[model samples]
Target: MVFPTGSLVNLIAIVLGSCAGMLLGNRLPERVRYIVFCGLGLATLVIGMQMALKTQNPLILVFSILLGGITGELLQIERGLNSLGERLKKRLKSNNLRFVDGFVSATLLFVIGSMAILGPFDEALRGDRTLLYTKSILDCFASVPLAASFGSGVLFSAVPVFLYQGALTLFAGVLQPMLTPAMMNEIIATGGLMILGIALGLLDVKRIPLSNLLPSLVYAGVLSYFFM
Candidate 1:
């Protein structure tokens, strides 16, 4: 499997979007920021609803959530994340900036979706960059609103995006034998549903503790192993 140059492209987009959003964010008024946030919320909700309808197996979804939530809770991902954020804030001396929210939200948005996982696999296996290209575009757009409200935190998300996707692409070469097409599709669909929940949280329509379900990806992979 070959690595796609698209990962580099995606990184470039995130940096560009963050810089643009930060520059423009300073000029925007509070009202404008509020409106943008509201718009993002709505967009998130729509995205969530759309993805939530993709799953054909409700049982997988149910068990995935249960198992994943337990694992995440035990791992204390949320707390660890908050602690990391607090350290960053203290180091930067930006305690009032709410960097944690932006970092966590943007990271989740960029990483927990079907495209984020599948794009790397496609790129490595087929030298196809289409999925990643599309995802990069969406992330670029999403960064605008996020930057408007969250300052440089939205831009910082690019770091995790790079690490997460880059690692997946790198690992794809070794993992190829385990990932069949049917398995990949199921994983994508499962990830899509998770992204839907993330979208809902972003929209403020529902505050789903998505971090607690991070293990669903693993569960999906396990299920795929048996079913595929």
Candidate 2:
């Protein structure tokens, strides 16, 4: 059995990057960090567009997003995620004012990207770790400035990263027999839209409630199973 090596490696990279950032303190300039984030955002945008283009069923994709967006809003998934981040911040008893911000931002940044979803699926379905490996390197760099600016709270994001991706990997393994190539393509396309939103947020263009769109992935799969 192939382990979820990708997530484990990603978790370690985040931790190490956070520690390095904290150690470096204010040495890393704000402008440099900002540029790095911008570069990441652009890269994410390109990746998302590519993934979105893979869908063979555009109508199903639209319906999945619509239905999933409604369900997610009704459930207040984004609010719940923010509330969880705030709770963790309080529980940690850290005086850092940016603790919650760091935790929430890092969590969204790491989890909302296309790689986060597709990488796990690949690993579980085909034992391929290429995307996850690439994501790990990108995330390691991303974590450094996040920790530098937001303090140690950035490290906690690793927890959610492991939990979210690890669960996806396991779930994908279970569904491997049922999921067709078309289903996978639709699911990835839905995730790509959410990733585009995240990219906008990272680029400081606009903030979208991406967590609220999580259900879109499920909708994509269901819609594909039935219609495609």
Candidate 3:
């Protein structure tokens, strides 16, 4: 069994970054935060596009997305995520208006990227922490500005980071033998589409219920296994 040491490191990084941001947050200009956020959006958009373009079978991608979207809608995954965040905010008895926003936004940002997906896979399959280590550095810096903007709620995002990435790492360990190169590509492509939507939301172009599309990655893998 593979231990999620990388995710542990990521969790620690987020905690440290959040604490540092809370200390220096007031010192950083809002304009600086805004510009940094926009930069992250642009970079995420490019990365999403690059990952999406790796699809070997467009038909499989389309069907996977369609099925996954429908499944996610039925499951109400986005609503559940929001409700969870809101509940956490309420339990904390906090007055921060952006608590849920911060929690959800930071969770998405940390969870949606290619590094978030591939890093765990690499670690589980080959015991290589290189990708996850790199992601830890990136996420650490990203959380600084996010925590500065969102306050203490950004710190809580680390919980989901641990859960999601750790789950992926465990599942990858079990599924390593079954996963084909094509299936992996399809899964990544599906996640890429979700990331693209997330980028658009960050850029203020549109808000997509990316959490609702989470099942798409599963569908992509299933379809790729049989069809590809």
Query: By how many angstroms RMSD does model 3 differ from the true structure?
Result: 1.7
lDDT of 2 by residue, 128-211 (tens): 999999999988987887788787888999999999999889888676778888998898888778778767877889988877
User: Least lDDT summed over 10 consecutive residues: which range in candidate 1?
Assistant: 48-57
lDDT of 3 by residue, 1-228 (tens): 689999999999999988887777788888887887798789889888998998999988889888988998999998999899889988999887877777887898788777888899999988999999999898888788778778878899999999999998989967777888899899888878878887897788998888888888889999999997
Q: Estimate each model's TM-score.
A: 0.89, 0.86, 0.92
Model 3 bad stretches (over 4 Å) = none
Task: Point out the worst 10-residue segment of candidate 3 by lDDT.
Answer: 96-105
- Please tell me which model should have the higher TM-score, number 2 or number 3: 3
Q: Pick the candidate with the highest lDDT.
A: 3
Q: Candidate 1's residue-wise lDDT over 22-54, tens digit each?
A: 788879998987778887777766665565556
> Quick one: best TM-score, which candidate?
3
Cα RMSD for candidates in order: 2.1, 2.4, 1.7
* Backbone atom clashes (below 3 Å) for every candidate: 1, 0, 0
Superposed model 1: Cα runs more than 4 Å off: 1-4
